[model samples]
Target: MWFRRDLRLGDNPALLAAAADGAEVVPLFVVDPTFATAGTPRRALLHDCLVALDTSLRETGGIGLVIRHGDPGDVVPAIADELDATSVVVSRDYAPYGRRRDAGVADSLADHDRTLRGVGSPYAVDPGQVRKGDGDTYSVFTPFSKVWRRTGWQHPHPAPGDDVRWVGAGSTGVVSDPLGERPVAGCTLPEAGEGAALDRWRRFIDTSGASDGSSRSAVAAYDDLRDRPDLTGTSRLSPDLKWGTVHPRTLLADLDASGSGEEGHTVFSSELAWRDFYADVLFRQPHSAWENLNPKLDTIEVDTGKQGEEKFARWCAGNTGFGIVDAGMRQLLATGWMHNRVRMITASFLVKDLHLPWQWGARWFMDHLVDGDLASNNHGWQWAAGTGTDAAPYFRVFNPTLQQERYDPDGAYVERWVEDPSEPMLDHRVERTEALRRLKAVTGR
Candidate 1:
């Protein structure tokens, strides 16, 4: 089984399929050099995850992950040829780069009379599964979510049941670090691996008996307290989801067994739906990864010169003078993660207050977030810029002061991150007007 995103063995459809016929499975992971672009936190977390996967394989299946270093197109097929394997199995990847990489690997495998079989994906409902009656993708989230719910998803496959034979890394004829050295991440990352992931999820949904001494599940209060950065009201599970330590199907199944009718459960389910929706959008329009999904917004004026660079540098350093924005940026710098509400606030500050391109902020985020996925990060930036599939209207600019007063009323979140914030770089009122003027100039709205 070729492990890419799906690291955990439990509920992994592709892994189970690989061992279905009682085949001696070789658990392989290629360390692609291209992954260097991922930020340090992500790189470090990935190393821990790989080590954890190896541990699980050793404990349960009497084997370990085979570590190879190179382009997957060459490494995968070469490994297959060496093993004389008939087929390689994997969970499908939907991002532009992953898709292209998989296609190349498939062709290379065909040359050796081998096949690459894709059985499942990282998402509960794979991209392109939910569509309108006309079979076209949904442009808006609500309609797409409704169809997605109706389309539903399969129950997660159990981990391989049969005691299967295995190929050890020593016999693979390739050698690399079993537990790779950790990259130097600037901030403290959560514990990495499948056990950690499952533990975190159980605590979030209150499935685990241990609650960190809290009376309520984080999910129970998610709808009410999720907006507050001061409290631990959110799941903090994005990193796990990004790494595929626990599948969305597993989460959904747990929610189903719990009271699915609760508002918190319903709201959290919708959040997962947003993840699927963005993936679908990127799957259909790969260029939307960096380009504006709505072409009309192409003419929207943004700063890209020295002035913009200075402003962006200030934003990146968390010195923007706006308490809430600074706090959010600092949180990201410190933890490689930020609260969802603050993400929107900081994004709007960049696009509307400082008049910078959303792409700049998006790139910065992708360089920093441990949980960053291309479809979610880029399309989310487009949503803030009013150039993606959502109703984040360009006319509705976020006011940083009002936002701080509303979301961080006690000033605790800002205080936690910002030691001494500077004066506001630009007045929200002035920039809000300038932003609307630019939008009107582009589309005559």
Candidate 2:
């Protein structure tokens, strides 16, 4: 069984089906060299997740995950040939590179008269599954959410029965440290693998109830608290969900059982739906990963010169004049993640204030964020650039200082991440005026 984003063993369709076929499973993990060339923080996180997966499989009496380093198009077929395998089963992936790689592998396996089978994707609801009554994709979020809710989900399948046996391949004897010698600086990652994901869910539920004795209680207040940067208000599950450490069905089932009030659960569920929405958008329009989602906005001018590079560096280095923007960037650098609200604020500064292309910011995030997902990150940048489906209008720029005052009221989040802790906060009204003038001048608006 080949694992990509779907890392967990429990409730995994492909792994379970593969095991059910009654053939000895050669569980394999290939570290694609192209992935290393990308060298993003996610690469390291993937390595850690693999280590956790190997440990989990060991406890279950399966052979350790075979680690190979090469282009999967070359390596996967070579492995199959060496083992004389009958079929290769894997979880389906939706990303551009993933789709291409899988196709190549399938063709190669076909040459050997072996089949390559794909189970369902990582999402609970496959992208583009839910649409309007007219059979067209819903572009706006409100209508999309309504239809998504109506389109419910299936109960996740259990892990395969233990009767499944394994076939071992002799170790490739390649000593590799995929995640490097140590974890990234300032990143204290959560425990990884299936056990860790389930444990975290349990702890979240327990602590949420400890104060109110109701699973739904915390959720009822989620909408009110989710925007606050200083509080641990949002579920810190993005990283797990991004990496497929936990299945979305499992999360949705828990939320459904919680009975969190209509508004709160509605809001939280909508955010989850956005994940599927972006994945669908990417699958259908992969070029939007590099260009504007709305082609009309491709004409929107951006500064991509030395001046733009200088501003981009400032933003990346967390030295932007805006406290909220700098704080968010620094937080991402330090922790490999940033609060959702801060992400919007910083992204707005990059596209609006700095006048740099959104791709620059997206690439930087991809390189640093452990939770970085291509679909989400690309769509997020496009949203900030006013070039995505349901995007904020081109003129609706975020006022960073006002955002700080509103979301970080006491400045705790800023103080925690910014270097100059004592600098007087910039005036939002003043900064907003100046930023607007700069943007207008650059775009001839």
The TM-score measured for candidate 2 stands at: 0.90
Encode model 1's per-residue lDDT on 324-357: one tens digit a residue: 9999999998999999999999999999999999
Query: Candidate 1: lDDT over CA atoms?
Result: 0.88
After superposition, candidate 1 runs with Cα above 4 Å error: 170-180, 207-215, 257-260
Tell me each candidate's RMSD, in Å, in order. Answer: 2.0, 3.4
Clashes of 2: 0
After TM-score superposition, what is the CA distance of residue 113 in candidate 2 from its true location, in Å?
A: 1.7
TM-scores for every predicted model: 0.96, 0.90
Q: Give the per-residue lDDT digits (tens) of candidate 2, residues 353-393.
A: 77678899999988888788899898988888777877586
lDDT of 2 at 429: 57
Error of 2 at 69 (Å): 1.2
Clashing pairs in 2: none
Residue 388 in candidate 1, Cα distance off native in Å: 0.6
Whole-model Cα lDDT per candidate?
Answer: 0.88, 0.77
Q: RMSD of model 1, in Å?
A: 2.0
Off by over 4 Å in 2: 169-186, 207-218, 257-262, 419-445
